[model samples]
Target: MKLPCLSIIVLAHLLLGPLSVNALGATLDSSVTSLHHGSCDINNGETNCTNIIPSPAKLHSGHSSHGMPILNMTDLEPQQRLFWEQYDTTTYWSIANDHKVMLYLHTFSLIISVMALYPISIMLSITKSPFYIPVLTTHLIVMLFSLLAFFIYEPSTPAYLYPNNAYTKMSIILFFVTIVHYVAAIVKSLSEWVIAAGTHDIVFDDDNSDTIHSISSAHDDLDIDNLEPVTGQPFETKYQNQLMANIMANKWVNSTVCSFGYLSTLVFSLFNPLLFIYHVIFVFTGVAWSFRIGMGNQVFNVLAHFIKGGVFFLFGLLTWARFIGAWADKGWAWNLNPNDETQSDEEDIGNDYEGTKIKINKKLTMEFIECFLIFFYGSTNIFMEHMANTNGAWSVKDLQHASIAFMFLGGGLAGLLCESQVVSRFLPNKKHAISFNPFGAFVIFWTGILMSQHEQEIPTSTIIHSQWGNLLATAAVFRLFTYTLLYLKPPTNAEPTRPFTEAIVSFCLIAGGLVFIQSNTETVLGMVYRGIDGMFTLNVTVGATALLMSWQFVVFAIKGWSERS
Candidate 1:
């Protein structure tokens, strides 16, 4: 009975607690309602009584919640309203300024022109053909035009005026380099004229009648296998003496007017070999400068796109060059066994001799270079990504990118170790000329997947990322295919295989790099505001890449034709 009573009391309190509280609250609410009704009633018609009732306070004039100004378009002047309208809806137009457009066109034209000229000049120079000087002159003229355009039309914007900016410094350096090159070209031409006059004078000289006869006699009497017993002179002494006599007899060679010309010619001739390299750098710098101006404040983003995209772009080009036998002399034309040679009769004669076989230095192949570059890029990118953070603290985004760098570092390091001689000794196929390392391809594939899945706040950016990501992934896949097919039917000779899959790989990489650059935030926004979609941008990238590849093939063809001639 006692336990039941205790349980009953607890159940009553739990069931009626809310009802009892509600009853008391309702009584208080009625009393307050009655008091309010007495103070303000429609029957009394008392306006003062209504004012006594409490109410919420209204917002202050010209201000909204959180003390923000309430912008009223009607209150703004015509000019101010127009400015606001343009600012809100015309961001894209403002960003794509006239100066940027001019720079873009200039850079594009300059790059295309240089691309065609660089290979042509190289071929002409190597063959010492009659057209070499003219082609080189044309190249210099083009550079001069580009420099003039840059100096004359480049906007004097604050960003470009910044003294410490990299692009500004590059422009300054380019100015000096172009001037020096122009002067060198002038000196070289003058020197050539002097040398030509001297040669013409020496060749047609009738006074030196015995010169030709003596040279012919000495040349005919010279025996390569026998030396002069009494004179004990070098084999070419007679020829050298005759040649010197003819040179000294020439008035042009002996004149003081031609001395400086000859010296200048000799000095400039040393740099002539590096002209192609200089031209390439000149064009690339202009392009980079244009990119910097167009991208605005995102320096790191610009660098990321420029460097990574440039590497892949170059990789594709090199692959294509390799396919066309650019480096066949170095045994780097994808040959399986470049060092293996057929046993000739002379070699066979020494086969039984243990010490007869000569060992040659190991050749550095393309795959090894790829692995080394991948490692180097990864190692440096680790610090680079961290340093990109302005606050010196790693955010989630920084870590995310840094993780990719780590992956590259590991993959590249492993490839290097495997390709190393010490590590190769433990492998089964140690004697193979190529190590057949797939880590580089694998790293590219992983990066593609990660980039493809990378989320961006803007839908346009996301789509662009996916476009390049797919291309990169496709390129990696085809690269792997190339490796597999080559391994199965390895080419024995040091000739370009020109595998079909390699072409696909080249196209993919080139296209992927181009698309990667287009995915920049500002670029995407500009395109978006101009009603350009991802598909249009992708099509443009593809078309440009194809055009570039076609141009590259033409360059290689010209090189091949020159070599044959």
Candidate 2:
């Protein structure tokens, strides 16, 4: 159906005067007086700021505005959530599969890309001998499937359509595959570290017998049961060395694939994945930290690490449940019948405060170490982006800023602690670090969005709009051509192409498109005024440039196919 267009008078009245558009903390179009996005309220010169657009009068500090609710996007809409899942399967899947040629090609490309980074400065400190072989291989496999997905996947349904059949399961499977490769690698590596550290300790120790005796003695005091050696090899020189190598190879993958459930929940389950991440961290920190202590009766010597791990993990889980329930679902962790409020007098003594003051100090210590090591040191040698910026390839909106910004905080830590491997060895205690940082993501998400939005703004003109307008369009076309050329180029590249070529081509296409589209508008304005077109003639050449860039994926994919053939 055709929508009504407001006349000039109505538009002037409704638009609330010309203001620049800004969202998520970035400004767009300093020259344009009005913003397309309602959220971009006018600031002195900023496009996006915390309180700029959200006027105090319109939305009280704690209240929401008449503007779109963030939750309404998908969080509050059950059908919309379902639609996204089905869309991943029935739509993006099919299209990607259909383009299997490009899918595999890029997948292979990603493998090469990952491997290529090995010699890069980042990979040096991971291990003396590139410890990320499993990760590299897994990355390759993921790329392969990504290619299969890109080419072989079909889009039989409309945008964001939820499906109910076998396709949903298939989509879920594909989703899990990605998570399995990633999380499993981490677990394997950590596990290998445990093995290596253990065996190596025995190999190098002057008092293996004494150390082992001490540990056993401690265990006996705690009444711990014997753990059958899973290494299955006598601790002999020859066998132990061979086993060490095998274990190290096994090191990069974790034993439990519960993390696999992560992607499943992401693609199929209806809950927020943030909850899952917290739970996983809690469990990992809890169980792992427990090993640092032994089953002992003494307070100072007891398995404080394990106790700490347990408390932190458990409390975090409990806190999450309570937070989500009381705030989100308005329910308790345990359900009590609404009709059954009567309590026995004897059982009611201080019942309201049973677990309230229970603190997990031990767990908190372990969790702090866990977060510090994993988030900071462990990930430094790899992608600095904690969360992948998926949209970075196309638009300004694709970053998880907080997770990433914190990554820098992590990297700074990484620079100092690259080689140490002393590790935890036990049931955990739940303590301080056990609780989830519920609002941590909000901190990162909004900040990243703000930074990206700021970056995307069309700034005050350094060059005349008319000059750069067409140039932006032209740059977009060049981007398409260059990317297409890269695809056509053989896979045996000596190195990844330099950024300058890509940059030049993309901007030229963008400028060219802007100029071409706006030229028509300019000419029309000129005729109306009986003078040269100066104002209201949005030279739309950039429009075409942008459109072509938007469609450049088609060219890149086609070139991929041609090269493969």
Candidate 3:
């Protein structure tokens, strides 16, 4: 049953052929001469140079002094080969800047990473964590660098891998979709948090109760429903005090943006039905589940926030949504029941640092499905890449299908295992189950690293840069070491080692960014200034920002510890 050596060789050739084709696209060796046979033809660098007389066209004693070799035209196969052989590389369409496309894709990917941070930021802010602003700002800056990277690099992706027009359009549209969603979410959350904290003086329009500013506080006793309009007090201009009011006054801005998003989704769905549908599903589900984890309240209120808040934007839409929904649910108010004697329940007053009581219901089931889908989508691509390295055990296309199926299973497991009851079985404390919430991100990050390592056909130097897996793997080992150190220490109320553990997370992230910047430094810097990697170059920009952010997080934790001491 042994296959012939020729058959095996043919199979290998077919399988490895694409990698070779991709290699043909490596950075051009500028030192090489562009002329064919050191002679110019009448076409002067046309793709097809028909009359290719030997270089110098020196006569060799023959009937035809020109000595031009002619091939028989009767054989169609050979004719095609001759036609291709005459083609000159000089006329090939090239990217304005070779690494521009890579920069664009990388930037957009970083933006997506930033989008992922909103949920965590919202959670921390609600609980009034001191690190809220810093954490959120770090992610925002990371996203900014991502966007800058693309433009700085000028997104000149290899044309063969991606059709310029289609890829460009898709990337731009997707970036906006994510941007709008985050902005809306932020607005809604900010407004809600403001009213909840009761740190601001809310202003209201006298005649139009609904039109007056701000939302119901998380404390149910506030009785926003019965608030009386203030008659004649100067409106305070302190940013925090009137934050909600200002946002609520311009509710239509977010509404218009969301409406536009809906329209765009509808239109794009026509051409890219699967992509459009998947993205919508991801956003909807991601918001719902993340809201549940971050905000922690009744289903109805979450829905209201989602509606009022821009579907996804920075915190803006979220601020607006919460403000508008509160205003609509309960008109203009000035702390109606500030005198209530009863203590506020956890549900009524959201707790930032602790978990909220979540009911297991149909909505919860949907959320689980959504979480799985998002993870599955991210992992499938990387999984297929590794599977492709198996030497004909599976075709790339088939491996893609297999990856999807496997992700479906893995995602479901992730959803199930994340449940409190399920996690409590293995962990020392049930309360810490929520900490595993970031497991999805961990999975996605590693998948990205693996994809880069398995990626085929790039130049050796490029591959070295792309292989951030090595860095990440080392980080993982270090993380395990930190966790062991934390475990050995006696459990205390403050969890003294908490800061050090968090530093590990920051370190891993910084390491990932460092490797990425290192690998793409040349191409990224080339886009801005020829050859030189300046102090403010792409890699330097990304690396510096990452280092500063991680350092801030680490220092914040250490500072907190010192203050306590």
* Residues 145-171 of candidate 1: C-alpha lDDT, one tens digit per residue: 665556555553444322344554555
- Top candidate, metric lDDT: 1
- Model 3 off-target regions past 4 Å? 1-466, 494-504, 513-542, 545-565
lDDT of 3 at 245: 43
TM-score of each: 0.64, 0.19, 0.36
User: Which scores better on lDDT, 2 or 3?
Assistant: 3
Provide the global lDDT of candidate 1 against the true structure.
Answer: 0.54
- Candidate 1 residue 324 Cα shift, in angstroms, is 2.0
C-alpha lDDT (0 to 100) for residue 59 of candidate 3: 23
lDDT of 3 by residue, 1-565 (tens): 0111122222222211221111122112211112133232324323333433211111221111121221222222221223324422220112256554654455344434433454345445444444444565665566556555654553343444322322334445655654554454455445444444463333344444555544333443322323323544223313333443444434464344324544543443342223323343344333222112112112222232233122111111222222222111121111112122323234332222244332111113222443565555546444433332224355553574456445545764675566445564787542320122434444434544554555322233234335444544444454455435433432222112232443444444444433343333122212211112222223343354344444334434443443343
**Model 2, 1-565: lDDT tens per residue?**
0000012112212221211111112112111222222333225522332322221111112222123322233222222122112211121222333444553353334334332321121122123223344444554465446435533433423333322233334334544554554444444443444443442221111233433222121122211121224554344423434443343332122223223434533432232233233333332222112111111111111222223223322333233222222211111211221222333333422322333322111212222343354345335423333222222242222244334455535543442232122222122321120122212222222322333233211111212234433343343344345434433431121122333344454434334322222222111211212212223223333343344333333323433343343
* Descending-lDDT candidate ranking: 1, 3, 2
* Backbone collisions counted per model: 0, 98, 39
Model 2 scores a TM of 0.19
Once model 1 is optimally superposed onto the true structure by TM-score, how far is the C-alpha of residue 231 displaced, in angstroms? Answer: 37
Score residue 229 of candidate 2 by CA lDDT. 40
What RMSD does model 1 have? 21.8
